[model samples]
Target chain A: MTAMTAPQTAPAPALIAAERVRKTFPLPQDHGGVFTVLDEVSCAVAPGEVVALLGRSGSGKSTLLRIMAGLIPASGGRVLSRGAPLRGPNPDVAMVFQSFALLPWLTVQDNVELGLKARAIPREERRKRALAAIDMVGLDGFESAYPKELSGGMQQRVGFARAFVVQPQVLMMDEPCSALDVLTAENLRGEISDLWQAGNFPAQSILLVTHNIEEAVLLADRVLVLGSNPGRIRGEVQIDLARPRDREQPRFKSLVAHIYTVMTHPEADMTRMLAEDNAEVERFRPLPHARAGGISGLLELVVEQGGTVDIPRLAQRLRLDVDDLLPILDAAVLLGFARVVEGHVSVSDDGRAFAEADILRSKELFRQQVLARAPLVAAIAETLRQKRDGTMRAGFFLDLLDEHYPPAEAERQFATAVDWGRYAELFEYEADQERLRLPEPEAVAP
Target chain B: MLLAALAIAAVLAAAGSGIGIGEVGHVALLGLATFARVVVLLAVSTLIWTPVGVAIGFNPRLARLAQPVALLLASFPANFLFPLAALLFIHAGISLNWGGILLMALGAQWYILFNTIAGAMSVPTDLRDMATSMRLRGWRLWRDLIIPGIFPSWVTGGITAAGGAWNASIVAEVVSWGGATLTATGLGAYIADATGRGDWPQIVLGVAMMSAYVVGLNRLVWRRLYRLAESRYRLS
Candidate 1:
């Protein structure tokens, strides 16, 4: 909140800005509702500043970026570019997509020339500018190569070259390095930092969406942290560090740690935050998209770190994006296996036992914890026990869940429940029949 | 009706009949005419259905309604229309040469429509967003993004449509209504005429010659285009 308000005092006009943006997508007809992806989120990117929108999977950061670029319209509020309302695609911006999005059939030269061609630049000038842009990205020798022929790293160079060729006022990138190998991603990140320091970057400002906390700390002058479950701005941080920032510096490490804290704050505490922000509290706890194995693996790592570990360091050590690690952490917390406090994760007593126990003992302990802590699994087991035949169709649960969740989310919740229940030996599922039933012995015993 | 005729012809072929090596030149000429007809029909189908299919596919709701309708139309036995088309041609005084092209197109055009729809749908959402952000519109958008995006599927549809058109020509090139029969100068007409006279050896020769043309055209042209699509235009 402080960072959001402080930026309003700046004298320079924002190159791209969003005013209380709200975006909703209609669910399938049978679901009978709309899913709110972003709610009353406001942020701005000023000239000569690199801003990073950071959040996990449900954060809607990418959706917000698209809305600002005017690729899609916000359901409510409006987007402003250069102090004017943007009606269609913003004319003063260029984008690099995470998927590289290069036309597979076009040569590298032609792909870089695509924006120029659209602007009706003459052929001779388009060719010259394209070559210069291609050369700037270190892709001079492969002008005739198709995107499919290039490696992922080289393909992204083309993505960069294409965007840079247009020389838009603001450049937007959606997880540009996410699709590359780790080494390639690192190399590209270093190059970007270098380019920013040299001050010859084609775009005056950059707005990138990323799930990497370290990436935000390294590349962005201002980092806006987004919260999930109807994503809104959770907090903002200003990096006052100088150029060619050192990752090993204590200040840099602390900023990374601070963002991890903001992101990993519990959802229960978020209820009060939601109240203050005047947004609806999420009544149903959506299951984190994590598997039992991943949850246990995360618990083992925590226990190995002497029952507690700093998350950013752990994430750095494991080479995981915040997107990959948060779900597993959420699952562990949901089952009472681990806890996160002030960016530090500590393995609970049960988590230690589960991590150290033999396979059979671990399964028994997992069953006990799931029945005691997981409401959806407990409800499923209780309903199966009450049924005379101990059998029910999965769609019955899906319909019940649809009252609270969209159809896709309802299906995912049912799937997670099935995985947890089956692992606990509380039920069995036949996918071909779409049926759920208690185990034969358990049904007969009751 | 055509199956019964072929079954009778099979029986006639079981009896002894002699064929001449000298017949090759004449059969080859007829094959060239039919080959030309298949190429021309395919080009026309490409021109018409590519745009229509792309339009349908780009709108997902529209595609859902259009796809099944297209499949249903393609499944209708095109030969069922021949007699009606023949009657219209006789009354209207139109040449069977041109009328035959329309009849063949009936069975073949749907292939391009459906394939183009699938291709348009498969163009990655990310690419579309990039295009929109870059402000690529109108002719620039089609030339740079949409056309290349759908090229591979278009080639695939074309191969199947050409195969269907060549098969349809056997019935399409010769149309009969009641006692009236119209014949066009192509390998399909030659085979139909040979079968009507129960000239078993000529029937076999004409069938072999048509098969040679279809297989050769696929090998020489369609296969090359398919390879180019696989190499250059395939989306990762």
Candidate 2:
């Protein structure tokens, strides 16, 4: 519904758009197939609005940003810049990288003038514009300083100056503040907000990719939440709040909470977004990056709170961001030990039992939960049981998982499965040998 | 001033030892020739390998294959080819002067390639992506991004290659194939010739002169460039 509402709300055509875009990278090994990063995902940034592409890691938000910038090509579909199919690098966009990707050898002024130099602007004019951009970012005296001499915040100011110097139609920033310290990040965020509010920002529109939900609410006119595992747009929320938004405002807090809920319910959102249901893929999605101990810790906390808690409030109480809390919540939900309805998380009866039980009883419950709900761990146990020696190389399972996940993600999933399996006593891992074996019958008991 | 003092001490010591002043002068002249040969060969090696290394380093696929091959080639003892090189010079009537430069390059060029490859590889993906998003291309990209990105690595390579060339000169300046020797008019040849005749004073003078040149070059040229690389060109 919000996706449909985008067209009616926008006053102008999109400055940049991805039309049914799909991108795939070659599998790292010789599997002879591709790994899909973005699959038929489409979003747009029109003039006069700051659009945030928000997602956790592996959601391909950055990849999508790169595609829209024409830094990399989409395997399928088109990236339209000013209503034309983009070719090579998009000439009308500039980017601020999370790394503050300034040339270390160049002075701040030279770094700011780089885009102008690339465009073949005359050197004197280039210097004047670069100096002005530098002044605008409050980096006037830093013009002669190299990036290494600057602090992270100062370096990012240089990054902003470089991007603004180009005066492109769309300014693309990839997690622009995520790499800074919390205090510095907040400071930069406020300054960026101030610049946007001042109404003299050089770019006509802004596109930001970030995993920080509060950041999206604070900065974006409309936030598009991206889903991972072959990234697709899961949901879109239009932030109707005016600029210079307050984080403590009821509307702002609610929007942040709503986006957190949408991000956590991957399968529910996917089914709603697509016409056909692909339950198998959703069921076998890679395990969340959470340990048994962490999941138990979260369950105990929820139980202490009377078994039901609003996710955002719980995150705030724990002083953890949604990104940190979501994975643990996802793991607990995946094991059928918890359920999330709306933005509130309620521990299931099994979760309460696991949280209160003694260590041995907890392991028994964990073993049952993992075997019944975790397909990868169950498959490993089953495969090891069928083997003559009751053992298999870890690579065999990794190779199997490579078809569904990227190599790094596959490796992570296998490691998580190993951790859970070992904790449940369903399987034993030989660290040095990289082999997995079923637990002996006696060891499996208790 | 320090180098000049060392050179004077060496010349006076050689002359006082009853090795004629003319002989010490000749040895000093030969040191200059060998130094010139090393400088020229290093320039040539850098010119050829910097671009090739940049090309290979920027492409991950090519770098994976070429890196090991360059290492393998660098490890192969260049002396094993000296006899063949000598025969070619003899047959083609090429002077040992030119042949010596080629022989030294054979041993020294790999340092540049290796360092350049590493430098190019170390150029951050973020910077390259930034350059791409800015639409920096061709010459501007090279000037702004690629060159400075790899400068520190290239300087490291240049330093190593120059050292390798100096060491290679002792063998490369004088080559022997099938009982015939081709000797270039350089300090390496002078040392070899002195050793053949049991002329210890001349040999000492030649070694001292060669050492003086290597130390002077390292201190004056390579050190400054290395400081520049560390101070300005380094990626944080």
Candidate 3:
């Protein structure tokens, strides 16, 4: 970043400027209506400077780059070059796509010469200029070769040559290295940095779009992070860390971590809120008709009534099948409506109020809990529902049970089952495993 | 065979001398001089046919007009025109030989002209665009860009024209009408006599000799020109 700062004093005027660009896409009525993909995003690139537009998928980084390059028209804002409104693709601005759209029929030299020839330079002069540009991209000896003869990286270099040969004032690269392998992308990035540092021949400024955070951190003097769900600029982070950045260094990691933390905090807070609300709802819900058979059922009943219930009292309320109701109470604690302290199960503060709530409120809270935990049970439920041969590994079945119930109860429920083979297809554990190997459910047959 | 070869060679030489004297000679001269005159006549005819071939190759409009016109001109019996041509030229105080030879060359020139136009029109579109973007326009464009651009077509047209010109010379050299006759000392007159007398061997010999010359010239010259164009100038 110190290396990047040296050129900041006399930063050139904005070569390409976009103001309040908004791109909205209409959705089918059935798909929740219209959505805005880019909302009033504005950014500028100074001449001879490199700026990275960093965003996750669907953040409109590529779209904004296209608009700036005049490849696409912005719906609501103006893109200006040197403070003059851009009408169409200007010769002073050249764009390289990630796909490296090179003309297959032309040799490298002729491809480079395309711009020169279009400008009507004399033949001898065009050849000389095209050769120099081709050499600059390090494709000197491959001048006579066609595009098919070059690798992905080499072809991209040719694309660079084609753009650079024209000596455009601004070069717009749309994820130029995204399609390449890691090492190739790194090499190309180094080459680009070197070129920008040298500042030869028209001295182009670059506006690049990428999803790679480290790439943005390493290359750009400033990285703009866009927020999702109708993509808009969330914040801009200035990386003052010196160039030739060490990715392993504490400073770099902390910066990345800081960005990540800021971006994810909203989602985290929402999850916590939903969990608390569900716990409240569960505590207030009225007990369903309970059969007087097991201590497990009595403990559930006591918890549903918004009362602090102990395992010993729960065991006395219902005739015991097991030595303790501790496992059942533990399972209830894990489900988040009750807390276990010493030997007693009690409603959590949120859960106690929820137990006395109106039915409608309880139902809404129940729905949220189910929806929140749906993904946890979805895989096992799908597997169980689709069972054909009636044999599933026990481990997978136990895992799903453990997610919904506490681990010890889940184990006990399996141990007391009437027909293990009937549900064997729902699990992943083998019958041969020592801890899980049980008498056939018929032998225990209770 | 020897007589037929010598006779055709002698007529070609005479045509060359006709072209050497001046502008009129180049366009209007007739009769024999030496063996080198055959080579000179061949060279001169090639020059006249070059642009005509190119125009026909590059310009569809010219080719459409020239194709049928050439066919009609080539097939028209020069003998049928002999009486009319003789009376008209004699009355106008013009030489019948020059008029007759000019008619023969015209029939031959069309083949070369049309073939050249076909070849030029067929040069690939990308190549045409490359030429255009290089700012090639007008006559220098025609010289450096268009002419070389259509060389292969020119060769095909040239070869076909050479055969047509040889055929045209037969009726051109031997003219007979109303008991007035004019003969050029060439293979065409010799073949005419042989045909009149039903001499099969002489007819066979004249055709064989012409075939040999066509084959030799194509292999030694036209083929080489085409190879250069295909390898160096071809866009693909």
Output the number of the lDDT-best candidate. 2
What ranking emerges by DockQ with the best candidate at the front?
Answer: 1, 2, 3
Better of 2 and 3 by TM-score: 2
**What is the CAPRI rating of model 3's predicted complex?**
incorrect
DockQ, in order, for the candidates? Answer: 0.74, 0.72, 0.03
**What class would a CAPRI assessor give candidate 1's docking?**
medium
List residue ranges in candidate 3 displaced over 4 A. Answer: A1-12, A28-33, A265-370, A373-446, B1-236
Task: Name the best candidate (by DockQ).
Answer: 1
| CA-only RMSD, every prediction | 4.6, 3.6, 23.0
Residue A244 in model 2: shift from native, Å? Answer: 2.2
Q: Clash number for model 3?
A: 27
Question: How large is the interface RMSD of candidate 3?
Answer: 8.0
In angstroms, give how far residue A150 of model 2 lies from its true place: 2.3
Residue range A380-432, candidate 3, lDDT tens digits = 33454476653456676556445433355445544433122222222333447
Ranking by TM-score: 2, 1, 3
Docking level for model 2 = medium
- What value does the lDDT take at residue A73 in candidate 1? 89
User: Where does candidate 3 chain B have its weakest 10-residue lDDT segment?
Assistant: B26-35
Across residues B1-236, which tens digit of lDDT does each residue of candidate 1 receive?
44345434433443335444446567778888888888889889888888888889887778878888888888898889999999999999998888899998998888888899899999998999999988898888888888889998998898898888878888899999999999889988998888889986888877867666777677778889889888878887
